[model samples]
Target: MKRFFRLPALGLAFTLLFSTAAQALTPDQCRDLLQQYYIDDIPQTVLDQETIQQMLEALGDPYTQYFTPEEYKLFTSSMEDTVLVGVGGTFSLTEGGLLTERVFEGSAADKGGLQVGDIVTHADGKPLSGLTLDEAGQLLRGEEGSSITLTYLREGKKHTAKLTRTAFLVPTVYSQLVDGHIGYLDCDTYGVDTLTHFVDDMTAFSGLATSWIVDLRDNPGGDYYASMGTVGCFAGEDALSYLLDNQGKYSAYRTAVESRTMYPALVLTNENSASAAELFASSIRDTGTGILLGERTYGKGVAQSVLDQTTLPDYFPDGDAIKITSYRFYSPGGATNDTVGVIPHLLLDDDLADEAALLLSTPAPAGDTTGYLRVDLEWRWYIDLDQALSPEYQEAFVALLEALPDQVKVWQGTGGADGWTQTSAAALAEAHGLTDYTRRGFTDSADSPYRASIDLLATYGILQGTGDGTFQPETPLTRAQLCALLAQALNCKMPSGESQFTDVDMNAWYGPAVNALASMGLVNGVGGGRFDPDAPVSHEQFVTIMGRLAQRLSMVMDLAWQNRPDTAGDSFVGWSDWAAEEAWLLAEGQTGLLGNSINLLWDLPQDIDPDAVTTREEAAALTCTLLQWVGILPELS
Candidate 1:
């Protein structure tokens, strides 16, 4: 059967139109096609360029391209995963040379006795050291029936081999059982045979593996349909991604295949993981089907459609084609991986990511499994009762376990330096019905009145604790932090462009949050074009921000309180003059805009400080309350 390819990062939305005649495409034709289908409007000046290449260059879109007949053939052939004449292996450039990452079975590399770890120092008598991976690959690839002499280093020893270039299909899926229990599947690309190969591997490992690890590191992505099918193997039949076209229309691309099985999965990613790989990772993360480990992915959220005779039959009588960026895609959660790639649930170094994943996936030992709680806190954590602790600590652990809510019992710790956390069990349990079996706990704020609120936010990832596992509940909330927290709570898209505030650095951790909220008119600068990001946010200030946000979101505010005769204007005293009206609207009654009773200064007793800074705990509580009201988070019992 012939396969249609959808290379999300480079090429997508394939419309194959076979033709026999060859003809040169005019600049006008190219400009017309782009104007009709490009993701953004083309400038008239750019369209009037004298040549096709010049017009494309003026447009400045790297993904959009005009392909000659020969180039188009090669591109289609590659997308189809056809047999190619070359040494059938993948290589990564290293200081020494090009390191062989994989050697295809029964191909030129394997037949020549080239191993996975072999570094090719020279190809055809030319030194390959210090060359780019693509440059070295160019040197190694050749026509069929051609031979090339290769000099390589294996295990610190030099070796040479004369290999004849032969036709072979590049393997896309590789699977093996790691530690005899983890199903480790490495997907190279989302190609035509990817779904089939992925299913075959899953079928092969059906009963043997208890957990699964999908490695998408360095995967450049391909075949959008195949990706949807493969991701469906884990995330089930849900809307995996949404596509938005230039005409302001939205279309959902749901998982095309049924879920094979549901197991805790750890997906590994890096900067090179793009397009379909990002789609797979984002769907898994957003749907709670898996946890992502390693670095953020390559942000390539736009897709291209190959235009040919089918799309513009009159313009293209020849076999040539033009690829145009036609749509922008988003994750099921409505987050785009365009410029800001998908952030991992757990950030890990590439060297230790696999080991950490294996450790996290392994279940607790069976013997005396009492008092142990298996929790899926970003990744899996097994909390066991350590007998070595003092009686008080042990008793505290038990009490904490018993106090855990039913959801905690069914759901899945503090992470440690090695990717697992070892903190106070009592503090973790009291905070969210979770306890760490390791020594020490969140020493600070253990007895805070807002411990529950703080931990609840942490549990849901709406807030993060200090790196030392301490919830600094008393820490004053800053304007930047508030924006960041609100952004996460609302699942806002990361904003593009520079910071609006002159004082705000766009590269800072909180910059995206501030920019996103500011762009939506939910936030404002202090004065003089400065955001004053580090300034403490007072209670009234916070309330006023929330009130503005509610208005923007069109939330229904309780009118009964606003209209009540007893609710005098003086009741909102102590609030800043500029914030008095908003304060009343956000916290005047039980069914305020937040949908919960927020004890602002107006509700507090006289003489109580009204100008006090909002603490981190207060910020978390407010954010959580808003989330619950908006149905983004469930109300805690």
Candidate 2:
């Protein structure tokens, strides 16, 4: 399917029109077709694109949508600032093929004692049966603060209940303290300045002043910018964020201003604080701005820009109504803080907190790896001038990306280091020195073509087959994976040193790799936390990683190759990470790598067989593309 999804400056412009011979489906008709097929299983497959479009025009409403959690996040962030949650009401087609019953559970109807057997004669005084159940339901669902008055027949009597629509803002933030002195700040919402508010609230703690806690108790966020602003306060005058886009470039930033707190801060987060909040808290903690105390955080590193408006296809909806991913953002240190949230330093739970404290106060009970690990973990996180990063190349090597892929077509098929999968696979192989050997895949017994490709890559040793031999491919690649992969891909030679990223756990398998990568300016994680070892990776994510590496290795490797006729002409320029000239390699298209770049989605089909693994055929395809990008392999067929 030749489709184009544009992330317009204002946001996504989904023009699924036939510019050539393709037919134009009016917005209305498109909406109807989707709804019809999605609901009633109606509508023809293909036709004169125009005829298909006209049919779309016949159905007037453009506001309805069927969404999963991920899709809903995109829809609400850019289109409708408010998304729907709890069922407003459910109705079925009557056996008479007319209007049968309307049930509103937990809504005013249910609250007012309405049931499933009831028939609604009118909604806000309008006849019900004439309106499709969806149309009626649409009228019922709306922005919070709007009221809907429904008149229904219950027990043979007509009754009315005026209900107000509210934005179902999911409350995910939880806060509390452990022991004494550790004032915990659990900020889960990037809900428009939630981080800032969290910081502000932290400043308000009037209690004792020893060690403080900032807890991100499974806090899924509301926005990225808000997350950055929140994290900025703690990060101080250090690069706290970066943006990643599809073109293999990133725009990095630091907190130029001063930090708010002088008091030592301890942050508590888990595999839940995502997006902005994750970015904010992770940066400071990683910098050892304070002690990060908790389990690993939920890694959600991709950033999405809502269209000019979030209430999509509704009033004032863009004619090109769709959510297009634009860019990804990250913490100050150069790190792929994607699906991998923050890992903790203390690694303490309520069960062990007291014992750990005594262990700290007293001594280890026996042959204690625990005490040794704790000390090294603290050194990795809290000490400045860490051994992992060379004093000279710290900032230059690590880069926080600018934006996520506005378009994810960063590679040709057949996997390679450029795409997220290859980026991940290659890193794992390199880190463990299994580059010459093949291992198992991410999954087992997959018969699909994609799975075959994954197996091939494993066989070729281009991609490391996991220890278990099954590629849990969909499991988001972790920050540690990216770091390990980058180091391995670049043929990274580890320097025996202290950890640089405050989040790196010295005892962890990826610890040394994390430090080396951080020192080289490859990737980072949220503040006050350790680098999470497992998380899924995204398209834009690896681009930023490559961008950082390209710059660091440029003038040495990638630059001279770019000026060749291969990069400048003969269609080679079309490559996602390709620059116009060799000089533009580090500068990222002369506008500079950190400039206002954007990319959200690409032309790749999402109908991926989830059960499949990455094969060598796929690896070769991707590897060839990346090899070309890194100036290693030539452009392919």
Candidate 3:
């Protein structure tokens, strides 16, 4: 959307002509122009390429380089389009050699006797053996009119011919759906009309998905407008980035107010993602519209511009040009990614590098660090173990355990015991980098206070809404619902046959969960072989069910603390306190042999109303905490 124009007369090629000037302009004039016009132009101190290049060399900036006319043209042409000068032949490799499939009639390849079905073995003196078809083809390409020597086999006879490089286009922007619903747009670079094509593809994708993965991996960079345009797609009228001139003056580039997409976005980057690509990803992340996932990017934070020929100083001519370091770009947060590139929010290992779709599908947790964990029955072990160790030792031990070789599958349990039991599953998950486990859908429930926990539980497939897109978190949780949630959260297997409760329908929605728990002896039938499926679960009843469930999970807590002499005057030590104390306050109370098990479960607020009827929201919060303690759920932050 931005346009640049040069002044007339002054726009004439400096090598051929000049206007009202006795002699050619000096480097000082060129320096002055850059100081006035460059986005982040340098000060008057550095006068010529020798001085500037030396300064840049000291700073270790490889991109600020001198460009001859030929190199400058090639660079500018690439920025305009992916069309490259080559011996225009579409090739396919065969065992014999590089076979020519199709050659444009007037192209250098066809005009040079490079016929279809010809097997090419070498270019110049370089043999084609072990070279990919694409690599061989690249060797045959150079500046237009440049000559290349190719050895080819035709009709079983080998012959060598020299060919000139000609221009042909290569595909750049590619868009498609990945993993059924995720829209994947891989942009190799931003060239002429690339933004137009990208906009078209994005419009097409809007109807296909509510989430997207914009892949900018290995993209070196392109025109300034194109970079701004790419960032504009996801940002509103906010500053996409800023530029700092040599004088310390800052200029901002902002996105158009009307050209923005609200769809949740995730940008894929890598160590090769640089310049414009880094800008796009950084803008997306800084604007609060997206998250970046992958390795750190290539730190090419400076912007470049071609010095107009007429504006060129006497040291250069029309056939020569230089691409100068115009300005140093800054991220939206005003941080420069020059030498140190932008780091991703989620650092992925190689196995997860291509799993962008899956990551995007998982709903991110609220900004709160605790929302990522889940509260479940297995948390007792972490609690007991932490109680036995000093806090500093516990922290160090966990770090050491996390650093152990994954093949060993070792995790420290209560009393520093080593075992292969299920209690060590969480540590194993961490060791193997298997963190993500849930895909929640409650992100749209904006007005709910329990949105974080609800979304987390839903992500893990432990709970879904009561239909109609509502979780009804405030409603009292019923016995059947609670049983179903517990079964799902614990991954309980369905048991055979039926329970003794007459009121429980075998074909009903909650029957399998009830039966599973009943078979495990974790739940009981009311009087007369009846289970009240619709009865609201009281705090005491909920605690009993959880305690029994914990026992089933091999984590048992003793009630002997209730009679502790140190806590004699306490009015009521309900199930909530017992669960909490068993998990965290183990050694403090009058309990004996407190190192039975360790559970790093949810930390309940001090004022938790233990005797109150358990609400669905409270259950979700508790479930999330317990899941975290047992290591079934990962820390969101």
Candidate 4:
């Protein structure tokens, strides 16, 4: 059932101190805690382990770790607002030494003239070239008031500086007005004070900055409350994420603070961005408040709960504790970011992402040139319609550009590059009057092999884009999302009232679709009154759904099994036993529902792996093929 938790004042406060000499919890106690709180089902083999460490190892969850009193103290300190006695800069390990990534203003690193990009090769006369990032950091940090000498390289020249280490609060939020028009907020971590700092910066840039860029690259996430509040500054007060526990209970985690005046935002992320950092990016992107740029984020969607004496007094009389994975969280759109990280709207090199955002935010220059159309699909796409080309092509392009809805602005631009628009192949075809346009403007699907199928489905209003102007064809299609698409394709009447599944909220965008499919007996819940809606649908499962859909539509399959192609029987061999019959019916020539020969669903060299997850493009192709066979959509020329 849907439940709500009172947002805690301190989202993950680990402040209770423990004695250095404390006894460790027994294996049985550890197993019991895990059994009660862990998000996933624990195996009997894990419970059979003899020691606490062995049990945790067998559990195979890296995030769930048992810590002694001393280790726990250190862990808690790291999670809290950090106070470090070290050189005031974040460094990334490189072949030569540590490459300075960020230099805090008015700090020892800044005062020592250690600019970003400078390599710190030595610390206190000790060479740091072969050390790990943590080892290098340890060498640089010292007790407060201690002096250290750092040798660094700048522009291929060696330099030296002597600086004293002092305890300073690690800055979580860094803000500045970029190019006097873009408000740049760089969050190193989402600590307790991050939200307040972000608000102060937003208030400062209220009138001056027209656009904003949030940089979360290399940010190992911090406090959950702080992250949610920070995202609210852009996306407004809303349920930013949904958390599911082991007991089949779901909780909506909403933003705590009021939103600020919103503007066009570009959120930058990288592989190092994890946990709460991912939450911020996903919330912003899913809410349509901004576009994500840079590499895919580090996927860490599960939240850990700290178990100690205060929470479980009977089991833990000693100071030692265990941090156990308690809940698995999903994005605002009901997609889990656990193993699948958030994909950016535009993937660009880390160093070039900021520059690209700046260019995107800047307005095009005034009328110096004409006969050029600028298409704004998240990014700028300048197309020179007047370039030296055939008149028929130009006429078709002009007609296509003109046919676009008022929402997608196509205006005059200064001609630079020749015909460089981000318009998808499907959009161009539909615009040229070849197909009835349904406004499925997905710029990212131009090069997809399934472009034809995607275009057909989109033209018929059976497929949809990811709201942010691109079709993430490679992204895995979730069960709930697939259900929504199927409901649209079949034109199922929307079911009213509450959803049958406990995890599926009726108010959610996919709720009615799921309920409609469930009411039709075409879909089923995972178990325990839950749908597991966010889980990716496997290939065999997707085909099985299609078979069920075909049956529900009362479509006839008169072709006999003996009349099927010679390769069809072999093709069905690899499919799961449960889905084998349905899979064979949909293969190639059996039901005339799938492609044959050259465009076979399970063609050679790319033979079907039944357990593999179905991608959005694959789903589109299969759905489009079915719709065409059923006369819902026109067959491909």
lDDT of 2 at 533: 54
On lDDT, the candidate that comes out on top is 4
Candidate 1 global CA lDDT score: 0.68
Q: Higher lDDT: candidate 1 or 3?
A: 1
Superposed on all Cα atoms, the candidates' RMSDs to the truth, in angstroms, are 10.3, 21.9, 25.2, 15.9
Model 4 lDDT, residue 314, Cα: 79
Residue 10 alpha-carbon offset, candidate 2, angstroms: 27
Q: Report the alpha-carbon TM-score of model 1 versus the true structure.
A: 0.60
Clashes of 2: 115
- The model with the greatest TM-score is 1
Lowest lDDT 10-residue stretch of candidate 3: 1-10
If ranked by lDDT, best first, what sequence of candidates would result?
4, 1, 3, 2
- What is the C-alpha lDDT profile of model 2 across 1-637, one tens digit per residue? 0001112211331221222232222445444434333222334442223443354334321322223233444444542122244324445544321132333234454555555556655656666666665565555556656666766665667666776654333222323333443444545355643554555555655454344555555556557666566555556665456666555456766555455665555565555555665666666655656545444555565665443224444422333333234455545544444433454444334222322232222222233222121122222111111211233422211110000011111111122322221123233234434333333344552743456444433332234545666554444455676666555444444667667656567667778778778766667665665555565444334444554455443222233334444434233233334222322332223222566522211113233222233233333233323333332211111
Per-residue lDDT for 468-509 in model 3, tens only? 667777889998999888876665656657656889887888
Give each model a TM-score.
Answer: 0.60, 0.36, 0.43, 0.56
Candidate 2 yields a Cα-based lDDT of: 0.42
Displacement of the residue 633 alpha carbon in candidate 3, Å: 23
Residue lDDT tens for model 4, 1-637: 0000101212332323222334478877887898999988999999999877678789878889777766666665554445556677777777999888667666688878888779999998899999987678778777888888999999999999998877666556767776687798888777667898889999999988777889998777867788889888987887557777898566788886776765867888887788889888878776777777666677787888888878877776767778899987666755555544565655445555665455446544344435544656554544443341244344334333332333344455434544333444345545445443234447787888888677555544456777877779999999999988987776565878878999999898899999988887778999899999899999988887886665433213322333445555355767877676567666643322353332325333238788899999998888876654433332221
Stretches of candidate 1 exceeding 4 Å from the true structure: 1-87, 90-101, 112-165, 177-182, 204-210, 236-240, 246-249, 261-264, 319-325, 333-340, 360-637
